[model samples]
Target: MSQLQAEYIKRILSARVYDVSIESRLHAAPLLSRRLSNTVLLKREDEQQVFSFKCRGAFNRIYKLLQENPVSGVVAASAGNHAQGVALAARELGIQAVIVMPQTTPGIKVEAVRAFGAEAILHGDDFDTALAHALALGEERGFPFIHPFDDPDTIAGQGTVGVELCRQHPEPMDVVFVPVGGGGLAAGISVYLKYLRPEVRIVGVEPIDAASMHDSLKADQRVVLPQVGLFADGVAVKQVGAHCFEVCRQYLDEVILVSVDEMSAAIKDIFNETRTLTEPAGALAVAGMKRYVKERKVSGQTLIAVTSGANINFDRLRHVAERVEVGESREALLAVTIPERPGSFLAFCQALGKRAITEFNYRYADSGTAHVFAGVELPGGSDERDALVQGLTDKGYPVLDMSHNDTAKLHLRHMIGGPARVPSERLYRFAFPERPGALLRFLSAMGQSWNITLFHYRNHGAAYGRVLVGMSVPEGDEAKLDEFIAKLGFTGHEETDNEAYSLFLR
Candidate 1:
């Protein structure tokens, strides 16, 4: 075995985490385990201090550093759990500590560092920027720099998780999924596990948009991403660490890239299984496990997925909740155009049986056409949705179903209405079947005569949904539009000039 791997195993065996700090409950999710036909165990590291396994490494590194140098103080840069870990470790060691964090970091994390008796310095916009500032300060102040990861000691410290995992489940595991940021957790656990149990596989999970480790492993060397998606902020690393990558290259079995949507869905699944909210990065292991089972077709093998952290921004939960169903393939979005006529909407609704409505948006101001945006629930699968869309098209309605398209979901759907026709003075809200061809029927019936001025629709994670629509019509066209709308059998309102709708559009 490599010296690094040997050292990591030795450190893991020797190190000791506070009894209260080590999480023991390995949750067995029957729903997920049954799907994969494997005994799936979750390592609930989110139960650790600072709500992350980072504390394990921080404490281990600090303890080792004190033995070597007996430092009076230490300095580090981090935006989240790392800062809290170092602060708590330094305070416990009776040593002064300084943490440099980005000014954009949440106030809660910043305050938590200070509450742990560490001096906190608000610096640049991100981890790298704060790290640069911290390094300069460390040089001038003569304080030891405590790296968040990358150091041998830190990697060894994190390997303790592997020791715990093995002790918790002595049975052989086919795979152990670990989330990778700078590759600290992955490298550490992989090194320890491979050395101790050569038969077990170690897989690293990273966000597809921030897959530094995946890129690095592919290149057979470290590589940096020009941009990283910050949705999974905790593991939004641009580059893998040199030390961690070296270990990963030697010990990790594979690296998997998971999408933000998959991670969001995994977070929702984790909440359902464990009733605990996890950050996007925290849920990555579970997402990876699902991807692995599907891709590799592995069955009857035990799997362990590490639940790494739970320090999620509460506001972002709204976005996750809205996209969860779609990610899970339970909802579909569609863009359809319908004839501007009466009774056509009702015919479209009848074609789509009991599916729920999640969102609806329509605009009727274009000189020759109107558009309707709709989101439908498919508690069933794609076949049912395709049937609904085809049924509407068979009835002579021109339907465009974009529910499965990502571009439409992110940009076009949110801004469906524009100044294609005369400006409208009024806005209206309406609801129709949240089915594939429902939008097309609604648009076709609105006809080429009326103009749409504004429209907005988003899936609100509900059964019956609502849509905000705006239209420009001639003074006497209200009766015609109402008459047309009433024939559709869907509830609609003439809020064309409503203050709230007008204000929101403006």
Candidate 2:
């Protein structure tokens, strides 16, 4: 082992964590075991003080620093968990601490630091901005800056998680999954594990959209990301720390990137399995474990996934709940363009068969053309969904499948359908060929007598098409409408009173 690795292990073992910190429960997860075909153990570090394993490192690092310097206080910059860690630790140690945070940080987190008795200073808009301010404060006040992840002391302090993991499980763990942000957690745990138990493989998980560690390891050096996704706020670091990178390069067996969808799904899984609502970063280890088992084919081995923390924002849960179906492949969004004809709408509905309509939106203008947005619940298999799309395309409709469109899945569909004010209005849906002059034919048949009220549509990469049209008419014009729609011979539905339409597309 290198001298630094040896020293890290020594520091971890010699650290003075409270007796309560030494023993976290290691419980088997049957749900994960079934999915991965391996015995999966969860290290419940989310139950720790500050609801994160960060406290362990912060406590140890501050104690070690104070023991050495004695007189100087500590300062740190963080948006959430790290700030809580330093504040709680400093308060426990009777040391003055200042936590610099971004002005954009949520109110809950700002109050958390204050509750821990740390002087919380709101600085700039992001972590880097806060860090810059903290650095200036540290220099001006002659206080030691406590880096969240970079320093040797912090890395060694985090190694204590590995120590506890080893002590808690008697059976040999074939693999250990750790979340990577700035690579501190991965570096510390992997170094300690590789030294003490060389047989165990260490895998680091990162959010796909904010994968600084994965990119760094791929480039064979530390590289900074131009932008980071904030969904997993705790692990949305733009760059991996230099010291942490060195340790990670030597000890980490592999780095895996999980999509925001996967992390959200894992968050739901954690809640279901342990009744714990972990933040996206906290669920990363479990998500990585699932990916590792599939990619590495370690089906029979005992695996451990670190459940790092549970400080999730309550408002974010609604977003997670909305996308969980998409993440699990249970929902699909499709854009279809159909002939702006009467019978065309009915034909499309018949093609959809019995699938539940989660969303339906459409727009018609320029007299002839129309665009439609539709979402459907999928049956069991990818094959089934593909067949459904193929069937729709075969009927001369241009269809665009967005079952995996991240943007649409995250924001668009939920806001597409709602109430509108158009009395004597009848709503009809149709599928048409996305071609020049398709709408002209339908509008020519409907004529200028009927007043069109609402129209909305977009292309989603489909050959065939779908659209929704709202028409306002005189109360006694129902018979005239039936004759007008019958002349077009397009597949469609008079959805004016359809309960589904009223609820989601009124």
Best TM-score among the predictions, by candidate number: 1
Off by over 4 Å in 2: 19-22, 296-298, 339-350, 363-370, 379-381, 414-423, 426-474, 477-506
- Tens digits of per-residue lDDT for model 1, 1-506: 87776777787778755622575468888878886788888999998878888888888888888888898999998867788889999888899999998876767777878999999999977678888999999998999999988887788778888888878888778899999998888988998888878899899999989999999989999997888777787787788888999999999989999887789889988898899999888999999998898788999999999999888877888778766776766677776666544333444455555566566666554344445677777876667777878876887767887765778877776675544434435566777655545555555565656544555655453454465655566787768777777785768887756665545444
TM-scores for all candidates: the values are: 0.85, 0.81
Backbone clashes, candidate 1: 22
Position 424, candidate 2: lDDT = 78
For the record, the alpha-carbon RMSD of candidate 1 to the native fold, in angstroms, is 4.3
Per-residue CA lDDT of model 2 for 138-232, tens digit only, reads 99998899899998777887888888888887578898999998777888899889988889999999988888988998999999889888888
- The models' CA-based lDDT, in order, is 0.78, 0.79
lDDT score at residue 247, model 2, on the 0-100 scale: 92
Kindly state the number of residue pairs that clash in model 2.
38
